[model samples]
Target: MEQANQNQDYQAGDIVYVFYRNPHTQDVANIQAAAVVNHPEKENELALFLYETYYPLSDEVAIYSTEEEANQAYHYYYGEATEGVLE
Candidate 1:
């Protein structure tokens, strides 16, 4: 999903939520990440990611280093494709 702030289009430093369907189940995932920068190869796609949140668990939380990684994570968590927007 895409959202504009102050009537301006989305850009780096803007927080965004990416929603995607679970690959196994028909669920949805809402992952938050920051836009890294403009991707020349992919005009519509931007580099985004989420860091592992602080938690006391055996494994660290998921952190997608790239937009594709995050997108794959969403798809894996949810069952279908997802669309997102500013929350």
Candidate 2:
């Protein structure tokens, strides 16, 4: 119920910002802009369009309504996430 309500905040054409880590290099991470779109294969489900891929829109993802928010969140989370990754 809560997830459904959250999904409603963005329409199919809405743009959102999210924290993304390089799949190939866990040490590299940053915020990325994504698009909210209906899932290509799922009915009535929302998906995030990023890097030419579709990811399910859910709480597991750190999504922000604006770039500022995403940047703030990235600073906070990145510090903790990369604590072991030496520069």
Candidate 3:
């Protein structure tokens, strides 16, 4: 969907998210990482494979290489997500 379309113009080292399902229970996992692997097919949708270490979770809802980086970008973009640094 949007991931395949939007990824065409992005290059490696770019920030992106990969939509994946857990192998055992098939639960959804939202993974974010620097674009390290590229899949050009439209079905692939995303141009990169995410590095596992950078993935975020509920308790770790906010993630970036640096706190300053996350704060600078997403701090005020949305109402509900504007916690921590935005406060």
Clashes within 3 Å, all models in order:
8, 0, 1
Highest lDDT against the true fold, candidate: 2
Candidate models: Cα lDDT each: 0.44, 0.74, 0.39
Model 2 residue runs over 4 Å out of place are: 1-8, 79-87
Q: Which residue pairs collide, candidate 1?
A: 1-84, 21-78, 21-79, 21-80, 22-77, 22-78, 22-79, 23-78
Ranking by lDDT: 2, 1, 3
Name every residue pair that clashes in candidate 2: none
Worst 10 residues of 3 by lDDT: 54-63
TM-score of each: 0.33, 0.78, 0.33
lDDT of 2 by residue, 27-61 (tens): 78777789999999999988999999999999888
Model 3 Cα lDDT, one tens digit per residue, 3-85? 13321354446664333334665633333344433454444333334444323222223334434454444434422343334
* Tens digits of lDDT, candidate 1, 1-87: 222222334455555444333457664456565444555455655444335322111112343444665666566654465563223
lDDT of 3 at 50: 44
Which of candidates 2 and 3 is the stronger one according to lDDT? 2
